[model samples]
Target: EAAVTQSPRNKVAVTGGKVTLSCNQTNNHNNMYWYRQDTGHGLRLIHYSYGAGSTEKGDIPDGYKASRPSQENFSLILELATPSQTSVYFCASGDLGGPNQDTQYFGPGTRLLVL
Candidate 1:
């Protein structure tokens, strides 16, 4: 079974401060992604990594950074937190889409509130 875990299930950050969200997956999937979910915008991909030691910018990479140290670990770094950045963050891992990619399994998610 694919398992994704995130640290600090909840977070409260001050504006201009830094918030780092960490994720780990034991699925051994090739592609891992970070996404944020809000009321209107829904889920937006922030960053993704194809494999260890490699990262890629996703749909919205501004104000956010990602690191993949190994196939089992991925981290999302928020350099400067803002109220607008408050949302639920999720980490997912799956095979690179085609016919092989089943479905991206997501973590429980981290709810971040920036004040």
Candidate 2:
């Protein structure tokens, strides 16, 4: 099974403050993704990476940044956090091929509150 973990299960940040959310995957998947879950919007993609040293913008990448330092680590960076950016963030890992292709394994989630 693919295992994914996120840091600082819960967080509180001030407006304009810098916040970083980290994720790690035990399975050596080729793709990693960062998403935010909001009440009515569902899970919206913030950023993703095909592999290490590469990052790509997703659906809602306006105020976030992503880093994939290795096959097992991915980080989400918020240079200037705002209340509007507060939400539950999730990280996922998956591969491109096999029977379970495109199937993502998600982390527990990180709740952020920007005041």
> Judged by TM-score, which candidate is best?
2
Off by over 4 Å in 1: 97-102
Query: To one decimal, what is the Cα RMSD in angstroms of model 2 from the true structure?
Result: 1.1
Expressed as tens digits, the lDDT of each residue in 1-115 for candidate 2 is 5399999899999999999999999988999999999999999999999999999999999999999999999999999999999899999999999998999999999999999
Instruction: List all candidate RMSDs to the true structure.
Output: 1.8, 1.1
Per-candidate Cα lDDT values, in order, are: 0.93, 0.96
Give lDDT: candidate 1, residue 85: 95
List model 1 lDDT by residue over 1-115, tens digit each.
Answer: 5399999899999999999999999887988999999998989999999999999999999999999999999999999999999999999998866776767989999999999
User: Model 1, 104: alpha-carbon shift in Å?
Assistant: 0.6
Best by lDDT: 2
Instruction: Write out the backbone clash pairs for model 1.
Output: none
